[model samples]
Target chain A: MTIGLYAPGASALHRLPAGVKLGALVAASLALFAIPSTIVALAAVPVAFAVYLSTGLGLNRLILELRGPALLLCFVFVFHALAGSVEEGIAAVARFAALILLASAVTLTTPVSEMAALVERLLGPLEPLGVNPAKVGLAIALAIRFVPMIAEEYRQIREAQAARGLDRNLLALVVPLIIRTLKAADDLADAIEARGIET
Target chain B: MTRDVSTRDIVYIALFAALMAAVNLVPPIQVAFLPVPITAATLAVMLAGCLIGAKRGGLAILLFVLLVALGLPLLAGGRGGLSVFFGPTAGFILSWPVGAYVTGWLTEKNWPRMNAVWFFIFSVIGGIGVVYLIGIPWLALVAKLSLFDAAKGSLIFVPGDLVKAIAAAAIAETVRRAYPLMQAAR
Candidate 1:
């Protein structure tokens, strides 16, 4: 809910190692794409939904999770319908939707920290390739942590612009938003340095 | 041009990536004429490139994309997960890092001479042109359309993207004058 699909459940999926879950998602996606049958893809949709339900995240959260994909699925169907046969279009949409559902279920059960740890460990072998997985993981954590705060700032900026009747003025809105964000970053840097984190 | 990345650089990278995600809070405006809705997230991508430099800017976007792939709804319209990589929107999302890198490269190379006009030019070139170059073909393939048709359909994004470019330029200029990190990479 913060910035990830994690639902903080105690399901078997939640207990699985992050790497294994990710690997399984990738394998499942490949398998879905490898199959060419429309009926098979459509039939798999229920199985995908079952995976989500198995996590015990509740129907409401599942619905919320599916909202974005649902809209996009409609768009995909419409485009494919116009360009090709409706049957094929449905197949394409079904395949994509099932894959998304399964992947989302994995994420819904896995924590971000676990994923980061898995990534860092996985990239350990790539140290010879000049890849600093620790730094990358830290960057990812910070990005995830800061996204919600910055989104609140964005919402405030938009509301302020709309209040001033300059909401339509893209420059007016963007300039202030950038200025504020830069200032906040500067302050954050100073705070970090003061805490002796790094220079 | 290569210096050890400091704590500040790390924070900046994270913050810019956060900014990229944050812009999605500003709901996409749907112009009835366009198939693709206009979102401020792309503007933030350009800002990340122009305000930060090539390496950090590109890394920031790469970070964002990675999160999206991990099933974070960081994209506009709350879209996320692995399926996004296989959809029509895949091209633009995949192009983000390269697009940011190109924009940052052009901006930093021309830092001394970079004015609002130059910022606008670079943003247009990297943000729109580069993104479209790859995005159109991918869209064509995914949607089962000809390249020309894909290009034509993309025209609807032009006016809005141009506006975003101008806005990004104005902001980038202000950040340069105030924060002056434009020359950090050099």
Candidate 2:
């Protein structure tokens, strides 16, 4: 449920360079998907779990992060079992769960700013192509920062609607939510301009 | 084709991205009669496309996807990360930007003159039509099912999506009327 998956610690994974962690994730994901063996995929799951355990966030945070994916994994397994073969089902679920756990591990260890820096570095080559990687990185940072704010706003709107007994009205709920959100966006735009971010 | 992205535009994109993420915080509406669960996040995506024009709308969704790929639990029910890209729902997730783009493009065509009917038509075309076009095939491939079967499986989403489209159209019209700045440039 937490947006910022980074868990503070002095673990080796936390110490790994953001770029390296990202690169490893890409490589590992590719490798997992490229190899179609069920046994290898199943083996990767424990390896991923072990790496996640090494983060020292304990099982609670891991489970919280994994809860949604676990539901999805069930659907995948069921679908594959019903529509495909048993081997295929295991292979698909294992590969998916393994990749998810590994990714969550990386996120749990790496801070968002580091990730943004990595993104900026990766996009550096595109400067000549007229791409502003800083802008992209800033956008990502802003999104992460504002996600909780928006979530809060949604809650506030819901509460307001409920107070007025208009909660059941879809239009009553959606209209004000959009209007208020857009108003918030306008204020944010003013704030950004005041700070002199490139137009 | 090149336009300067103002700080305002960047803020809009970020906020819309946040808005999409926030929509997920709300529990999904479950229909007692139907086995499928309907999420409001997709409606936020459609509303975003209609609110901002195509380029900005698409960028908003793109930024959201990038955050998701980087392992932010922003998707519905706090789901995120690269593993989502490999799942059966990957098609729908990946089609988000294209769907937003198409919806925004259609909405922009009639701009100031657009009414509820136009909004409804454009929203459904972009939200339901474009998303389904790519999503169904991707579902079939990832789920290893026949195209027809994939389409059949997707039917459960239709009633909910149509309702969202209608809501989007009405909301778009209201915003366009209430705030002139929200309207497309003629």
Candidate 3:
């Protein structure tokens, strides 16, 4: 559930410009969609993995981190193949894998603070459009940070529900989760106000 | 009227993003008639939009999209990346922000009672329609099918999406009741 990439490295990849990395990621993604070749998409994988390894982020940890999604990706490939042709399925799988690898690299390399700062810088130009660039940037950063926390919260709720012998129905999961989320948001808003973050 | 987003807000956004990604890794529900499997990720998108408002909601989806772009299999049917955007479901994938924006915009409008009618309309027109607009054409192009055929393929999703819209609306209304401060902040 943790979306934050926790690679403890100070490599060059970690030092590259966030904007540049973002641009490259976007460009690579676009290339993936435009290029229909399964082979080319497959080729992007090792190259991405190479970049990951070059970062000195533990390859074993990286692989372990990716294992869950990798398994899921395999399932998708099989499902697609069963649903359609092998070529199309493989192409789909490759494109997906490339995207995952590239994003993991970005998250692993970029710290949250830097990411927030980068977002602020990126959105700075939008202020003229009546958009509060700082607020927007803050919101994005918060969203990134909270994603994992919420996942943990949901898991806790599920576990708690299971302890009570709840059948793990969607309602059982979603209801308590939503209630807790609202409570969390309330506590959060109060804490912010207490800190004078808001007038 | 301006309020600074705090650390907690950031944490909420990140947690929602991760939750969405995690849910997406779950197996998509296979239906006999539809080409695409039904996944709860869209529900997450709607929830993100309803809860986080427009900008953050959109950003949250962007984060999820970026995660997919990074090679995480955090998409419907455990699919991920830019390639999903080129597939038959690409339109829907792209429509996430639009859907969130529309839903958030409607919620922001602050209708009293927050009834199902407004919710249904906004979710269907703004949320679902935007998704189909982007998705149908892409599906048509990729599948090399006629516009009509592509539109037909999208039809399979209508019932399911309607259900999602209703659910999103319900969740949204419930949140509105539970968090009165959310409205005040707005």
Q: Which candidate number has the best TM-score? A: 2
Query: Deviation in angstroms for B176 in model 1?
Result: 2.7
| Model 2 TM-score, all chains together | 0.85
Residue A168 in model 1: shift from native, Å?
A: 6.6
Scanning candidate 2 chain B in windows of ten residues, the lowest lDDT window is B29-38
| Lowest lDDT 10-residue stretch of candidate 2 chain A | A166-175
- The DockQ score of candidate 3 comes to 0.20
Model 1, span A1-199: residue lDDT tens: 4666667878888888888888887787678767778888899889988987888888887787678767757765776666667887788778877877787787778776677677778878887776777777777888778878877887787788789986666556556766776677778878989999762
Give the CA lDDT, 0 to 100, for residue B51 in model 1.
Answer: 87
lDDT of 2 by residue, B102-126 (tens): 9889877768678888888888888
Which ranges of candidate 1 are over 4 A from the true structure? Answer: A1-3, A148-173, A183-199, B1-6, B23-39, B81-83, B141-155
TM-score winner between 2 and 3, please give it: 2
Write one digit per residue (lDDT tens) for candidate 2, span A1-199.
Answer: 3556567899999998988887888898779767778899999989988988888888988777778767766765676677758688788778878877887888878876677677788988887776788788778878888878877877787788779986665666656766776788788777877887653
Q: Could you give the candidate ranking by DockQ, starting with the highest?
A: 2, 1, 3
B52-90: candidate 1 lDDT, tens digit per residue = 878888888888888777667667667676557755568
Q: What is residue B77's positional error in candidate 1, in angstroms?
A: 2.7
| First chain of candidate 3, TM-score | 0.69
The local distance difference test score of each candidate is 0.75, 0.76, 0.63
Residue A69 deviation, candidate 2, in Å? Answer: 3.1
- Those runs of model 3 whose alpha carbons end farther than 4 Å from true positions after fitting are A1-21, A25-117, A131-133, A163-165, B1-39, B48-74, B77-91, B107-110, B116-121, B138-159, B173-185
Q: Pairs clashing in candidate 2? A: A199-B5, A199-B6
Count clashing residue pairs per candidate: 0, 2, 23
